[model samples]
Target: MKVLALLLASLAAVSAQTEPWCRCAAFVTYEHSEIMVFEAPEVTIDSCTDDAKQCKNSCTKELNDFSNNGNLWLVQENGLTVGQNICTYMADHFFYFIHNHRVYGYFEVCGGAWEYTGVASQQLLCCNGGKHEHCISK
Candidate 1:
């Protein structure tokens, strides 16, 4: 009976693929940039919090430095609202996302660096108990 149980448990564990991606800690969103007409300045700021202001600035700078022609943007112009909970994904030295905050919605980067918990875009994360001063470099 013990052998059977152990084998079953092991099999269950093996069933779920757990490689390349791990759970991510809570990260805060600062600015919401919606994708408007491409090739034109059509980005609308959906929202912005005072707490996450600096973090957003830092993240944007980091992203611009990380990408080409200031093209690698952290928040995809995909109607992402500010103060939402979003996870980061690393794909071959570059983390990618289509402004998606839902856990299951991340199909392309699912098996990448980080995986978020649960579902829903209504779920928002906070940094430093909402002060968000320490939201950078995470």
Candidate 2:
């Protein structure tokens, strides 16, 4: 019985360490010329907290550097007002390609190196003019 309990506890701990609850994706335009768009599932600002604000500030600085030519926007889906704000902050800090109904990649901000968790194939379509011809043939 004790052994079984220990195994169960270990399993639970492993499950908890798995990926996070949210999802995200990113995509760039042809030859990376245009700042197409990137999207993230409903992410709570609390999740980002320190990173969110720092990201937002960084975006603002980048935007200021580009000034007139800078083009970046943030959109939120099924998220709270704070989540929307976090997205905006990210857009301002990192030059991400974001759009409606499409996300290219997902990552956990708190995670180191902004490790990419998953990517959306559908969003990749935007990269090469809706032609998956150049995409890695699976």
TM-score of every model? 0.20, 0.24
The alpha-carbon lDDT assigned to residue 46 of candidate 2 equals 42
Please report the candidate that would top lDDT against the real structure: 2
The number of the candidate with the highest TM-score is 2
Q: How does model 1 score by TM-score?
A: 0.20
Residue runs of model 2 more than 4 Å from their true location after superposition = 1-23, 29-36, 45-103, 123-138
Model 1 residue 57 lDDT score: 39
Q: Output the lDDT of residue 116, model 1.
A: 24
